[model samples]
Target: MHIKKYFGRMLLLSFLTLPFIQGCAFFDNYARIWVASGQYGTDVKDLIAHWQDYNISYAGLSIENPSALLFDTKIDGRSITYEKWVPVTDENVLMTIVKWL
Candidate 1:
């Protein structure tokens, strides 16, 4: 029983530390999104234009929302919807993408 507990703890610790050891790209990508989303007043279109700078790909934009920016991203080798919100014009163009949140 004690051995099982120890193994479980080790497993949890490993998972927690794995990102730090391997340079987690998810957090880095999120940070860029945060910044581009108006953390520093950067435009979202600029973010899309420079996705390659962060090694992230722009999968596409959302049709329903029109302001949602989608990315071809995954974390821990699993698929996830990495969506970022921004403003859009009536013609489907990005407005400002800066919201005070």
Candidate 2:
């Protein structure tokens, strides 16, 4: 019983540390990218242009209420409707959209 408890604790610790390790790599890849949240409009174009200037990829954009036009096409690995942006800092964006908790 004690051995099982130790194993579980170790697993939990590893899970917790995984994010920190991944975060480092994420920041390295997309530290230049910025996060923006607001209404979906012409602003998206402006943001994209800004990032392009820096050669930084668009990580993610969170709008208050997305529209069909947003997801009509895929911008990154995941569809825009799904709120999945490419070259993200990491999968952290998933957590941000799903829970919004």
Candidate 3:
């Protein structure tokens, strides 16, 4: 009986989390955008405004002074690929990203 109850709970948990797990890719991008916006003192709307520019998207952000600006870009007919930035500050972040794009 205990084993059956545990299995039932596990199944319920799986069902509850399935949607989030399935949409993780989309959510992850939003999360990265949020993080990047906060780190670079930019607005989420502003960052998202440029999301479709050159097929570039916010990828990730580091939690340090010299943060790594992660972005997704298409290359050579390939799927979107993650690219890294050499450490930069808020002042030059946009310029660097624009240059990269």
Candidate 4:
């Protein structure tokens, strides 16, 4: 029936996506490196690079810059921790993530 066909399609889709989800976790550091690449950000990426250069991995990154810069991030370490608020501006923008290694 249509219900069975729909269920099969959903199951197939789940299987296809599961690998990408798992791959991201297995290659978490790659994500950081990609984000920190100076080629991507003339300013904001530099800030991220600074953190990476120090081997400081953050679990989450929050940026608020209506007209300037306000960065809020959580460190990813033995224990996830929130870092102090950072305020600044760099005209931050990730050019394109498509070619990111």
The most accurate candidate by lDDT is 3
Report the C-alpha lDDT of model 3 over 1-101, residue by residue, as the tens digit. Answer: 99999999999999999888888675555646334445457543565455443343333443333333444433445554455634333434545554444
TM-score of each: 0.25, 0.27, 0.26, 0.27
TM match of model 1 to true structure: 0.25
Off by over 4 Å in 2: 27-101
- How big is the positional error of residue 30 in model 2, measured in Å on the Cα after superposition? 2.4
Top TM-score: which candidate number?
4
Candidate 3 displacement at residue 90 in angstroms: 26
Count of steric clashes across candidates, in order: 0, 0, 0, 0
Window of ten residues with lowest summed lDDT in model 1: 92-101
lDDT of the structure predicted as candidate 4: 0.44
Let me know the TM-score candidate 4 reaches against the reference structure: 0.27
For model 4, state the Cα shift of residue 85 in Å: 12
Candidate 1 lDDT tens digits, 5-94: 999999999999998887767665554533334454655566556544332322235443333344332334654445453323232232
Ranking by TM-score: 4, 2, 3, 1
- Among residues 3 or more apart in sequence or in different chains, the pairs in candidate 1 whose N, CA or C atoms overlap within 3 Å are none
lDDT of 3: 0.51
- Give the Cα error of residue 91 in candidate 1, in Å: 56
Model 3 RMSD in Å is: 14.8
